[model samples]
Target: MPRFPEVAESSVGLSDAVFSRLVARARERGGKVYPLHVGDTYLDPYEGARAEAIRSVDHQRLHNYSPVQGEPALLDAILAHVDRRSGAALDRELVQVVSGATAGIAVVVDSLLSPGDELLLLSPFWPLVRGTTQRRGARAIEVPFWDRLESMGDAAAVEAYLESFVTPRTSAIYVNTPHNPTGHILAARHLDAIASVAERHGLWVISDEVYEELWFDEEPASAWMHPRLRSRSVVVHSVSKAYGLAGARVGFVHGPATAMQAIRGVQTFVTYCAPRPFQLAAAKVLTEGRGWIASTRAHYRELAHRAADALDVPRPPGGTFLFVDTRGRRRDGESAFAFLERCVDRGVLLTPGTASGKDFEDWVRLCFTTLPPDDLHEALARLRQVLDDR
Candidate 1:
């Protein structure tokens, strides 16, 4: 039905450049624009885990392809890391390394979803996931849940709310915590609710644990560790957010052996293998980066408080961002894009809330960890002015 040059219908209208215009406008303003729109940290990774520390002299054939499952050392490190955290040992056959969580999630969706299948996304989610499902010709059903957690009543209410979105086409539910946009960690009751729904409907659970090491208070339990969800869940982990090694692009996935077999088969054609040298570096980081994580967590926690104070929002308990409701701050007749432009005029850029979910058009996501303390303070000051209509 399509012409030669036409792209697939599923790929059309996908978010390719949601922030390009704002970025270009920020550049035109030409004065110390702080990019708080990105989900990253200003800190460098641990010394032993840096790419420069992994040398060809130390690692034979460092540039060559790693085994699709992962480098043996990295695999062992991941297994040990899981054991230490979850108190359960993972069989090596259950793990497969991929380019990053982004690619890793894509591979899982590709393996689990068929055309027209539905994946329930907890709303105000990481922005790219909707597009990830769309590219697979699957529907991403956004349930407005995260931002409303405090007012959503009990765990029974949460379960009912999520269940309302499930249909015969529903095949999976993707859960992330210390969640993106909002920093809410799902509590035990919340996890129980999710597991109950998955069990009732026979849905696969996709646990996103990229921020597993970035919580502010006590570490939240991994969602995949729920006994009922364990068999059907595939958990994805990354050193990118935890170790400030986003450029390294290394992450791993593990689940039950049966699900892993499908994931491993799909991974072979997706990325073949993660970058070999970085896999070695990631292994070192996983095995030895606890102190680094502790310090960075303290640093980010401080920044979260500072940013929240400046913006007059509650401090995020975990993760790097604050999802702010800008409805009350916007001028009469002003659009969300116009509100963002005012911030850009002040030489600060934040992500539009619409990027996270369709229901969040008047909200915005600000990443407190993207800039160093001084720059972030300055950016928050400028952003505060816009929010205050100064």
Candidate 2:
């Protein structure tokens, strides 16, 4: 039989098996489901995105092929925004724009590691991080964090916990603050500990800050703002969550000039460049839309609280989702899939926590910003009813 190789087929990322089934069944049932599973926003693109998209329609350069690193205007605008926010003046030459955060992640993994090199990861992570590493023939050494992080208040203790998992083959560490699926933002001391460990080991740090602008209770923190880690970090940021521009598919990664050169080179074939019109639209948001960004963040913050209250979950300090702990709440012999199936039967769709990692097998994720206030309330009522009946 003609078949795929082991490396190509070994990981199918079936973590989403429950989600896929729910989606398929929802379509087959031929009616609407109250969706809290995805991170999509109920809002439109930012104030100026559509205007820029329209303006770029007649520009020939925006229509034709451009440098793989991205359009100059877009790159400068991004760096300017970064400098204003992080107080780190970066050289424009060190930045590379790509199709989206997903593409940016793939580019970094492929560019930074050789086959068999180990990439240290934090869990529960965005599944894409693990999938990309494995596909690049790299090993992922996971340090389970989310479960114990909130309880481990000491920064040095958190650093020590991460250090125990490191080995000689480890080449890089990935940090996702305002983390996906859980929406837990790492504290400043936690960021410092990770930075200290990375600096001491001479390991690369891939900082994913796509949710940088969505902090609700307090200001967000980043390793990019740390002086010691700046020389060896790849800071990946995006407009998808912040500006409601996910469909535009624009994101970028920047770091030390030397490493970015390699990352930029890898982009010559992979993605090549972000779509120009979208880049122009994103550039508008990056350079001149802080007020709009602040308002959007405020809106999501309000929704976050409402969702947390409805789900009976602790409100995350930041980000747009609430993580509902269903550990002892599940029926005997019921798997995460069965719990989610009941939510579906009750007409609300949620992302089973197992999809992100097994560490979260007893939880589920629900996004607050994805539905209107009343719809969100109704959706949670359905979810709550299912759990109550269980």
Candidate 3:
């Protein structure tokens, strides 16, 4: 077997360890697996968007490589979409399309973080955030955003608490609004406070806004758009969730020209450009489909409430996933791993909290968007049975 580096060997494994066992059991029983453990939508792409991709492929757009920055039409459409949706004035020079938000984030971390540097990450993060930082020979120092949200309720207090976590080696701050796992959407005012702290500390900010369009009751905001933070911030966005186009692998990052210039070279070495037709298709979705996204937001909001009420947990503020405490499900002398094993045995699959963060070992994250109402409700009901038995 081939060996790996010390860092690679030491890094946490992100596999849904329990889900694999669940898949095995499903095969053994020849029954449908209740899939509530993924962040993808089961819905089809909008007709207009699908047709655009087909049209491009039919005409052979996929055969050509795109500009290193982005397809011009796609970049223009992104600028317009961001301007209309977020009210941010951005110049064309500041934007560059990469693969997906995941790759865009990797590009940002690779560009900004250096060896022996530290990145301050809001904790219980997307988990891959750690790999992105560590792979660059940098460090991701996770600060618990939810713990701070609870202990320091005020925006100013939360900002100060975040500052306390910083060290001299810190190079940047990575934050996600409508955060994955917790679904905690940072308020505009809270984001402003974070921006202020970043400005004062002379920190670059990488804002993950992939879930920006999924907010339930609140208007979404990003740290990159704040007047104080704009010059030092990069925002990563994608069409995966809002437009049901994860397969397209189209995402972009926008920042001041100074940072974009640096990131462009790195992106060239890494992903070069997103698939040409995917970029054009995403542009079509952005330019042609706003009603679809608005309705999706409404549907997820209602479903979030339904799931939360059924699980007896608080409603997720945004995003398609929900992190629920499964501590109560443990039986005598059983660990959370054991609880999760039992859940799989009962035919319901969840991402065990171990994969996300050590601090969340007693929790499980559910993705409610992939299943229809009936399936989701059935899955949750099965989860309740597993939790209640013994």
Candidate No. with top lDDT: 1
Cα-based RMSD of the predictions, in order?
1.1, 2.3, 2.8
Q: Candidate 3, which segments miss by more than 4 Å at Cα?
A: 1-30, 51-53, 56-60
Candidate 3: lDDT of 195?
Answer: 81
Per-candidate TM-scores read: 0.98, 0.93, 0.91
lDDT (tens digit, per residue) of candidate 3 on 246-274 = 98899999987878998998999998999
Per-residue CA lDDT of model 2 for 1-390, tens digit only, reads 325553244255425355788877666666668888888888887767874454644667567776788888898898898888788778888888988898899899888888789998888777667878887878877777876787877879988888998888888999888888678888778878888889778899999989888888768656577777778899898889988998888999998877898899888888788888888888888987888888988888888887777767777777777777787777888888788877787778888776666677787888888898889888978877887876
Clashes of 2: 0
The true-versus-predicted C-alpha distance at residue 389 of model 1, in Å, is 2.0
Q: How many backbone clashes does candidate 1 have?
A: 0
Instruction: Give lDDT tens digits, candidate 1, residues 293-335.
Output: 8898898889999999998998888988999998868888899
Give the Cα lDDT of each candidate.
0.91, 0.81, 0.81
